[model samples]
Target: MAALRPCTLLLPVAALLFFCAAGFAVRFPDPPGAWLLSLAAVAAIAAPPLAALLRLFGPARWLAALALLSAFAFAVESLGVATGWPYGRFYYGEGLGPLLGGLVPYLLPVSYVPLVVGAVAAARHPRSRPLWTLRSAALLTLIDGVLDPGAALLGFWVWPGGGPYYGVPASNYLGWLLSGAVSSAVLVLLWPRGSPAPPALLDGTLLALAFWTGVAAFGGLALPAALGVALLAAFLARRAGIRGCARVTFLKKN
Candidate 1:
């Protein structure tokens, strides 16, 4: 608990920095230390949910989950880059950090896994794994709905054949749907039965949504911004409902 205190405190701060940096980048030229700030921010925001995973599932289980998901993300992304079947023909830019095997970002797992964990945590279904998986996949796809446009605008990646949504193709979202399903499935398969997803676990998804929301708004992409706002509202409302239920149960018991 003592060790986790700093991480818990750092999550929101890191998220705020990323949001500001992303918004600034879209609004103006890249600032000094932007890449470094981004790297640090990503690391910070990713730490808490990962810690939660380890705490909830144990190190072995969490590590296995991380490895499997990372490998899958890299393979799928590499395939997407090479063949353009799932995500459309897109190539990464220099902004997202070093490439893995010169094909995908090394930080891919670091950025991706936590989002999966957070989605599972946020999904409405608790007893039904199938419904949970579907809902989590949808959440992830919705996240990409906001994220892809802003990321493309920021030059994190490029789509040579741009589509209508801020240079992002519809196929990209279709790819996210497939990826999200597989990713959520991996999580549900490994997840401990009857284990509740703690509210703190939602930190990563919230951070991503908030950061992308600001980025999209700053970039003048109205739809993505609105989607981000809606997602945030839904998550917050769900969280409130859960807390309310918990309070009622506690009072009833008392």
Candidate 2:
């Protein structure tokens, strides 16, 4: 077994702390408390993936990815809020902290970029960029499948039209699909030549799945909870398969 890095432990610890705090915060309504908790949650979720990206791709590439994705997310979100073309009409509440231009949250990219990085890193068959992009986009959508409902329940965002799934419109997911595809393409382009995604990259994604699964279950949203569990299972299975293959290769080499 490969030795675990000390930094790798930070993700699980942060996740657990956030999950516990979130559980309490959800039950008891405290505006100031919720705002602080939400900030903490964003940091906890985003830090690991950003670290992984830096470790894998170096600072220059990491910065590039971060800048580009942040701009893209803000633009798309602003457009969505104003025009409602892609993600449906959604308005943000004050819980997420200050809104940029009174439109989207300032911390949008901090949370958004990590999801794209983690999803692309978790994708199978990295050599095939097209397939990787498609799969990563789908994975992003699935992650949103868990996230939107829980966000709605928590009053992070409100979908005025309100669709079948926990007040989130279907158009929001379609927006995610499009956004995910574009984000995946950007990651693929920025990826270092002849380098595979680091295994540690998925840590952030796993933590997200675990946290959201708990949130969904706590909120009594069965479908989103199930989807979170299923996504976690699929990712874990993929990790296990990769490890098994590595072991076989090592034994053969020996």
Candidate 3:
């Protein structure tokens, strides 16, 4: 972590940005392209983990393992979606349409990119383990399970064939274990560098985006899905120390 100053980290980040732009353009083309194009795109998604790994572990060790596993899982998932391979039993709805090699269809990882990044940052920060768990759980539930689906409904994105095979895509959430627990743990293990924290207007915006998009997205398939998410967020916030619960009780008293 000490070696990860902004100046030194600049080049890898620039490369990450470049690859993401190139990958997104090709992989998620307006009409999408052949499997080769999709493969390159899939490969590009590995950039963040790769970049972070380089910074964290620097030549070798645990971060490399996480980055490698993450890339492999992403590869399998992208290929599976493209060809309807191994876990091809499910389907997303028509609203999502056939996306770029089926990769663009789920659009789950976009939301999760920020989520896992934030989670890692938070966990690595000075905080109690239980508090981190509670915070992380609430964050994941809202960001991954709730907000992402909402965006899919608004034409922002869609899960055309995201059949909830036993609740959520086994691939997406499964990779999260690598990102949240394994990757975070690895970072902690290697370096304990702490820095002045940055503010989060963007984070707040993402949360709002998740909320609005979730409402818009889920309201399409089932209004109940939307309403239920709203209620759930309220409940979880209360659980996490948000203080609006008493308002309901006060209203009832009146």
Number of colliding residue pairs in each model: 0, 0, 10
Regions more than 4 Å wrong, model 3:
1-112, 122-138, 151-179, 186-192, 201-208, 211-254
TM-score-better candidate, 2 vs 3: 2
> Candidate 3 — worst ten consecutive residues by lDDT sum?
242-251
Clash pairs, candidate 3, are 91-161, 91-162, 92-160, 92-161, 92-162, 93-160, 150-213, 150-214, 152-157, 153-217
lDDT for model 3 comes to: 0.40
Model 1 error, position 77 (Å)? 0.4
Pitting candidate 1 against candidate 2, the one with the higher lDDT is 1
The sequence of per-residue lDDT tens digits that candidate 2 reaches over residues 44-134 is 6776567767866888988898889999999999999889979999988877878999999997887788789879978856568899889
TM-score of every model versus the real structure: 0.87, 0.88, 0.39
Query: What TM-score should be assigned to candidate 3?
Result: 0.39
lDDT of 2 at 128: 83
Residue range 192-212, candidate 3, lDDT tens digits:
344321212013222333344
lDDT of each: 0.80, 0.78, 0.40
lDDT by residue for model 1 (72-119), tens: 999999999999979999998877778888878887888898889888
RMSD after CA superposition, every candidate: 5.4, 5.0, 13.6
